[model samples]
Target: MHLLPSNLIIFPNWLQPEELLYLDLERVIKTIATHPDSNKIILFIDTTSIYEEDADLVVSSVLMNLLLLEDLDVTEEYEISLLGNADRIEWESIVSCIHARIILENENQELLTSFLVKNIPSYKVEDLSNIPLGQLVFNLSKKLFLEERWKEAITQYQKLLEMQSGDADIYWNLSHCYRHLNLLDEYFNTLQQGIKLYPTHERLHFSLIIDFRQNGRIQEAILSADHAAKCFPDDYTFQLLKYLTVPSIYDSQAEISFYRQRYTQGLQNLIQRTSLKTTEEQNSALAGIGRLTNFFLSYQAQNDIDLQRQYGNLVHEIMAVNYPQWCVPLSMSKLQPNNKIRIGYVSHYLHSYSGTLWLTGWLRHSNHESFQIYCYYTGNEPDPITKQFQEYSDAFHHIPDNLPAACEQIIVDKLHILVFPEIGMNPQTMQMAGLRLAPVQCVAWGHPVTTGLPTIDYFLSSELMEPKNAQEHYSEKLIRLPNIGVSYPKPYIPPVIKTRSDFQLPDDAVIYLCCQAPFKYLPQYDFIFAEIAHCVPQAKFLFLRGTLLQPRLKGAFAAIGLNSEDYCVFLSIPERLDYLMINLLSDVYLDTFTWSGGNTTLEAIACNLPIVTCPGEFMRGRHSDSFLKMLGVTDTIAENEAEYIEIAVKLGLDLAWRSTIAERMSQNHDRLFDDKACVVGLEAFYKQVCSKH
Candidate 1:
């Protein structure tokens, strides 16, 4: 090959008979861009071996000739011929552009002749019905799928289905398209069809369960998982899912005890099975185990500090293997204080969730010159508030879905202090939080429970929220900041005034709204509801059915000799505005025991409703009590369960007393709403912690 300039390579030699015929077009393009002389007449023999040096060299020669063609006369004759299997000529443009006249002299090349005739508009300009159907369909559909043109991909797959009936893979692809388009009904139908076509396909069965769960058909989801587990006994993941999908609702003390036993036995078995494995092997096994353990631990009945600590220790062992501590401990080093401290916040809930509501104020008002804030969001969905957090931070990163990639990026960022607001809610973040990725790793009360990981150096909490002896509650050093550590913006009240009839309530009834999720209601607290109902006949408690726990709630009520239907009305999950409206409309806000409402408590205050709180032994149970105390309203903070019922009933019957409490709430609204001193306290704590290092 004679190599020419103009970023083109030309072959000076003819093709050898034994060479491969395929042209690597990608390499040819690279050659054409780097050669020097643009204008050159390149000669090619009839049988030019694309394998001479590389087919890329031939493509470069041809492309260069075309580029220099503009400089020459249009009538300038450049005679070139490629005489290989003509059907193998993938690039028709090269054949058309490099020659003034073309001739095909094959008597029996039917496929090649037909292909050119069908594809070239000037020759035949016809449909390709005679072409092999499967190749064309596969290539087109695959291309469309790769480009993410989901609708067009669906159309291509549909055409494939018409040509080849009962293809399970095609149905799978179509179902995926429906899912991406949010045509959930179609997605389900397609998956069902796929399952019919290929009955034992594990992926399709698993996907059916996922689709059901996504659409909120919890019972069906559980059934599907249960069936899958029974079908595939060796796959512990399906069995784990079966256990997990069972609603965290206990009807009585017996059920609670039974579940606790199962949870403990399950954890011990998982730990033993993965005991002698390598770290990667252990991590793979622990994925399902971690989820099962975390879910059971979250239920109020299984909230044992020792079990939590044990879970943390197991997680720490995995972290020790998977994400080894590579950083020198900051506490051991003496450093100058002139440099700005690099603080990074890691969480999956940096969007319009509870974590954002509590942490946004710190980002908005923190002294940027003193602290460099970096937010690493693991959440896939980003909202307007997520953008706000991005704007306030010095640097923001959306951590990739791949766990190792996210950890690598965090390690590269080299944060001085890494804070995870709530590590328990998401598996990926929880796994990452267990790793020591920074000098100082701290966790906050977004989930409002101790992480119990040895890698977690400190538990950042509010002084008001914790009990008197809170140090014993956490595995890490408990650092209590003043107030809740952030100033909250005023919540929006819905403008359209809703009436009692809008929610199927009687006008004469005294509405005591218990707006917490159903999972927060412990069976132990069910008697309190019965007591309140008995004490105040007009007290109608409102609840939101966020979980599939209504039957359990009613069973608990029945245990206490009360009819749940007469005492309580369960409402569907509402939008933010509707939820606040319900809070505003109610006569009193009854806080849940144990897992108290952190965000709802703030909402109750913003709506100026009288709240009755009974704080518990742990910080998780005392948020509303803390808020009430912060606002200087202690009358409703009951010291015991009896007092909780007494205060709720008093607020129910004594209209004047209710009004007085409401007035006091309204008067101290500013104190409860936007306490900027909280941020100052947080900053001081941050400085103190850094100074120690």
Candidate 2:
């Protein structure tokens, strides 16, 4: 007889129904009842189980993993006797060490971790020698993974793999550790291994699709999504994921239109067909949906507030179905003058990413006495930026990846305002954004798009970025702050001096630096490159190397009768200093049309480069324009495409005008950085929101 585990028991070796299949849980319950204060287990087994497979099941220590599934309150321990033939197994091979636990949730995990350490007083974090190897290592590994201590967990999991080579979970979790460490190659490789080794592992396959989309390999992601949907016919997650797959960079405008149409049709079909019959099915489907985002939808340069609201409503409905209590709007308590209002911020990008560059300033410059700052960082990596977030906040929580556990943690905090730095960029953030965790829920401009979720009460934006009609762009009530909407800290310039030769730039050529990622370059703007290359013989557009979308740009150049090889320069820079060097050396900074630069523009301006921008209809396109307006440098701000090309050309051709613009940028750029007024406005906004609601 083999009990599979918690809640479910399986007797696999029932060769004769009358004997082996006659076992029931009544006798086991009776045994546990009698020894209520002690650990007790009862198993009905005999020599009728003669097969070697049956003996292996009874003998293996891994099967004992079930004891950890439930909350066992007993103070004493129990023993098991393995019945096996002498030739099949030796008596000494039995593992008779103390029983181990598997961590199910954060509370139980802490208890188990403390228990393990108490057992062997001197046991180190990595040491698993004193206890039974498999159970302790697995326990420690899960603990470390949940706590975002990935490297140590990787060590323990790798040890588990050496013992059980065929373990699918080990491969899945190792891949998870690699992902948290930002080891993309290892992450991809391990996912591939898991997919090939255990083709039926649903999470491994879907996770690969997400990885592909994240790394800008959208085509591969689409293929993997299609394959995974076919493989798991019953699971609606894969089916929904197929529709959620949006490309970061489009080869053409028509390609964008095609995908937009496909997504709408696919989403409609998904809505019509999705009818989850059981609680498990509904939970799984919603979890998968929660991990998806409409981040790429904003890049299309169209108004999607209605579409977003529709999708948001669907997500809200699903969330309400899965978590009724969490979806309900929380009641607020009016704060006393002496008491600091508890404010919480949640995001995965509180680490060394573009998100921290803009948002951390708000944290750094906030009035700590009047308002308490609590950060729920969903990301795994611990960087210098993350350390700063911890230092600046009142309570910094490195939240686990599990949605319910993380949500419960935030609920327990009893925050006055729960803020998501951005909603659409991260899946878990999106999941939380759809729920009313606090009395006042607000989303900032980290991703710079409105979350259509009804749960969000406010959208924080910049006065300079949003147009007069920008109120119509969001589902939430818009709250615009002064001067670029961010208390942006000035970027530190490395003191190293370098010549143009260090980067292999042509001495005679006029370098136009387009520092935005390849996705930011719309297909219609490809003609701008060919036009500039045709006009100025010495024009060379500089871009960072190692992206798949570069070839599409090259092809666009080729179609317009220009060999991008001669006119474009793609160089691999070593570090941020080198990127800043490119900004310093470039003749003109060319901002993308529809999706204008944010952090890159700020960095380039800080380096004293003249930014030429043509703001689009949406706020996303006006970031650089806002920065320029804030700096009192308006000469390079173009009103149209012709003006954009003309301004860019003049900046490239006229050295004196370029220098004049650079000098003006250098003089007035101080006003744009570390603006305490922006923080003051934000704090006031928070106070106003609290009082009104």
Candidate 3:
């Protein structure tokens, strides 16, 4: 046989020979040759066996002649053949020739298209009715998913699962689609089904765990995490997930230590398994460890600057390519409503258990005849305090939904100053503040940290809360209220010494009481108290039990060598304020680091109980420090853990000095109760926000 040029020789394997006949190939080849000046002639052939040996020779001869034309046309042909009994022998040889020619010419699409035109429809659907519709539906669903049409994709996958029930992968994909759509309930329901169908699937279990965590079912999340750990024992990601999830459920000093140990072990294992010599690998490891470190630091009572900086650097590195939120100067022209200034307070903590409890006194006593107060409560829980705040306001509105919607309403209200009582603490509240709903948005004591959002115009601070130069670290403008902190109506009278004996502690034992949240016990603060316990052997540490001081949290303290029997006493008082005033039974109050007690510290000072505070670098941390200084009680200031222990012990030991400080603190307490002064400062701030240049 006279062979054509290798480029012009179409391979049999490219054709669907089982379906296409010889006539199809002949017509395709003739069409290409008709155009002599065509740069490329694509000829698609069926299997070599479909044509007789003589016919093959004739086709080869025609292709060779076409290649030799005076114009030297670029002639190409794709000869596709199916592997029947006879064609298998030539399939390998033809495929090798086609690949070689493709490499030489660097062009194959035209030739491939010609082959498809002749034979594709024949074998593409051998019997369309017999095709697996489930698979077809799955493929269609995947296409929709890639297009970001999650709802449409979910519908298609649902149809596929209905047709072929118990497909684990289908259910998994459907769950993923629901998650993308933010249909959390549907996501969990689908995941439940997926886990039921494929109980052994580790990825599905991990997804369930993550969903539980995000939805606030921490205990269920921990259980799911344990399941994932068991299924994927060697997977470092799963192990880390378990370690990270445990802290959210059991947020105690002991749990913190437990998770820290696991984190360190898992981190070591990950480092050893992965080579960190490259920048990418090092960065990934750093990011992972940095997240774990943050979780641990978050549970600590004190802010760790080094730890925070590490986390911030890692976040910046990861998000360097992403855009940041736009912060613009707001125009207050529309903030004031026709000769009246409207102040809006947005918070999720407006209920009974809130800093709003402190605001109740101010609200009850404010000169409401001048400025109008509007409260936007995002929380659903209605309590006496919430009702009181509503009554105090000129106009009160429930947020009805979330922060964004609430902010929209606040903007419509044309509020001159919008105050955020819960800033960094409530995620939704922070999101609302980020929207810049008012011309002047203020942050307050509901959260102790700098909101870190630039939209907040000012921070409601007192000399006791944020000292001089402290405002530099905050993003908001500082508005200093008169006195150290706001005072609420002290309704509960201090219980007598007999009430203290009922808690089983000696009435005479120098009591060192801390009614703050148990989570506030930083490791260093724990050591400080432990040192004090060692110094003042007769002193008993009393921790008033509230929402945070559970048995598990107490166990955490036990793990750190402070036994419940020895130093820790958990007592639940009938009335919080009344019980708080009973701190008088305890000679001295020890303030926790990071979150210094506002109401609790105030109550302590009011009941003539002197509090020793060690202020940290942050605003939330400096409240007690500021309060002590404003009261002219500088001896109560402790610069570090050692000083905290020293002062605590000295106060417990020296009866005369303790009584003198308490008497002095009582006089300072009188200054703190000047609600009129606070009102004056607050009114000025409101006017500033409402006044235009």
Write down the TM-score of every candidate: 0.68, 0.72, 0.54
Q: Rank the candidates by TM-score, best first.
A: 2, 1, 3
Model 2, 146-206: lDDT tens per residue? 8686876677676666656646787889999999887989998988888888889988997
**lDDT at position 57, candidate 2:** 59
Residue 590 lDDT (model 3): 88
Off by over 4 Å in 1: 1-247, 275-283, 286-293, 301-303, 325-337, 553-562
lDDT of each: 0.67, 0.74, 0.60
Candidate maximizing TM-score = 2
Q: Tell me how far the alpha carbon of residue 552 in candidate 2 is from the true structure, in angstroms, after superposition.
A: 2.8
TM-score of 2: 0.72
**Clashes within 3 Å, all models in order:** 13, 0, 8
Give the runs in model 3 whose Cα sits over 4 Å from its true position: 1-330, 334-338, 365-370, 400-405, 485-488, 494-498, 545-564, 572-578
Q: What is the lDDT of residue 218 in candidate 1?
A: 55
